[model samples]
Target: MDCKVKLWEVYGDRRCLNTFIDHSKAVRDIYVNTAGTRFLSAAYDRCLKLWDTETEQGKPGFTNRKAPYCVGFNPGEDKQNLFVAGTSGRKIVQ
Candidate 1:
């Protein structure tokens, strides 16, 4: 894997819009917030990253002892800043 995250515009013309290359390993999962303004990614590099959709910029936000397998953001409007992740170690982190 090239270790890149690509964003696409699906409705109009259906084309790639941006590419984010921050994780050192293959991205395992991605979660986009409900408003579509931000996203989170989990990677084999044992880290979770947060990205700003508009700016096309991202960075590692949390590191796990085991590789992160999946990630998601809280759906509650009042808890949008919260998130959770599952790791290879069979543990969940919030």
Candidate 2:
């Protein structure tokens, strides 16, 4: 069965600005880019979704080979991004 996690943007005093639905078996990890332009989520669905934070919508991103336990973006690179996901084994999707 697929489950979803709600994403929320917190603002000072306001608490939340936006909320989104994550359609995955289990949302295990999330990574926001340094520019805050995008959000990457890894889940048991064995997929990673890149989302546009500005629009609060999903963007085309990478996919994993198995259920990802973690997701992160590598630093020190411009124009290029690195996504590391911990699945049944280590998988790197760039």
Candidate 3:
């Protein structure tokens, strides 16, 4: 079987928010947190942006990193909501 998919993001007027990202490396995957408070986007750009769903802006929590192919929050942990990012050569950011 073969499958195809299209992705898009609409914000505010749905027309004013027209920002395109060239993930030439590849946007391998995407994941959103359970609380819906934050979302993590992974790309070949070798970087990850933690977005604030409520304000539609980047969160200041996690910063200073290189391009990441995958990212997610640590499951079954508390006190510190740390993110785990996957990069090339079997590297992980915690």
Which one is best on lDDT? 1
Indicate the TM-score of model 3. Answer: 0.59
Residue-level lDDT tens digits of model 1 in 1-94: 6588898889989998999888888999999999999999988888899999988887656888999888999999879899999889999999
Off by over 4 Å in 2: 1-11, 90-93
> lDDT of model 1 at residue 44?
89
Tell me the number of clashing residue pairs for each predicted model. 0, 0, 5
Residue 19 error, candidate 2, Å: 1.7
Clashing pairs in 3: 46-66, 46-67, 46-68, 47-67, 47-68
Is 1 or 3 the stronger prediction by TM-score?
1
Output the number of the TM-score-best candidate. 1
For candidate 3, write residues 24-85 as lDDT tens digits: 44555566677756667666556566766566666443433456767887665462267788
True-structure RMSD, every candidate: 1.1, 2.9, 6.9
TM for candidate 2 is 0.73
TM-score of each: 0.93, 0.73, 0.59
lDDT (C-alpha) at residue 37 in model 3 = 65
Candidate structures ordered by TM-score, highest first: 1, 2, 3
lDDT accuracy of residue 73 in candidate 3: 77
